[model samples]
Target: MKLFVFDLDFTIWNAGGTWCDSTHPPFAWKEGKLKDQENRWIYLYPEVKEILSELKAEGHMIAIASRTNAPTIAKQLLHMFEIDHFFDAREIYPGSKLTHFDRIMKELKVAKNDIVFFDDEYRNVEDIRSIGIESVLVTNGLTKDLVKPYLTRTIARDLPQSEAC
Candidate 1:
């Protein structure tokens, strides 16, 4: 199965144009909203859960490759959303996208060609592509339709050269 990696922050949850403060305690999930210590609300994009669920159900390995400084809070948020269990690997920390993917590939034992990444940043898309991984830029956040073409293309590309025709 292919490994699918994702970014957090704007890519998963809407942080309201702000980075999650590493100093704040973990967020609290209540009545479908995640609130910080100061009661600032953060929400997962509406389509994230459904897309992730479908990918997991299809036997693809899901993972997180966030550059959030607040790694602890990121983990808490994932668990709060109840989607943490879907991830088979996670590389959450403050670092370059290259470092994040390097660790993720090593931990998962997957090659660059076998992985697909989704991020909301253009620079990240470029970085991932430089390493031979297929990446999708999630401008308005992830949706099933946005991901389908990449999956189809990757599957076809991985086919034997003779069979690709």
Candidate 2:
């Protein structure tokens, strides 16, 4: 079994507030610095929930690695979408997701090589890769056709089935 991590912001939903865009949620702005906001999910992608279910059944532990101030937002979004059951943990409002990834890996006693991550941002993907985790970049909108190439065992891992794939 392997752990599958994901970044929330641009990877999942394009929430109205984005640190990358220099737009902060009304509650996040304070003294020229951005604070964290609460209670919101930008959007839920079609089949995202289903894909998660398939992964779960395939014995993968799903996790969310997001940079947000309010961790509650992550919980709320998961609960709202009925996707909470799939995640082993919801990391919200973290200063650095790479740090969280390290903690999670250590706590779970899994090697970084066993982790698969999905991120929309190139920087975040690169950061996770630095720690030995493999990450797939989520496109503007995720589709089976787009994701098919990487579903093969070759790019994702060196499983025995790579030849068949």
Q: lDDT of each prediction vs. the true structure? A: 0.81, 0.65
Error of 2 at 30 (Å): 32
Candidate 2 residue 25 Cα shift, in angstroms, is 11
- lDDT of candidate 2 vs native? 0.65
lDDT of 1 by residue, 51-102 (tens): 8877877778888888887888888877877888888988988878899888
Superposed by TM-score, candidate 2 places the C-alpha of residue 4 at a distance from the truth, in angstroms, of: 0.8
Per-residue lDDT tens digits of candidate 2, residues 50-84? 66766676677778888766566555555645677
Which is the leading candidate under TM-score?
Answer: 1
- TM-score, per-candidate, Cα-based: 0.84, 0.70
- With a 3 Å backbone cut-off (N, CA, C), the pairs that clash in candidate 2 are 28-35, 68-93
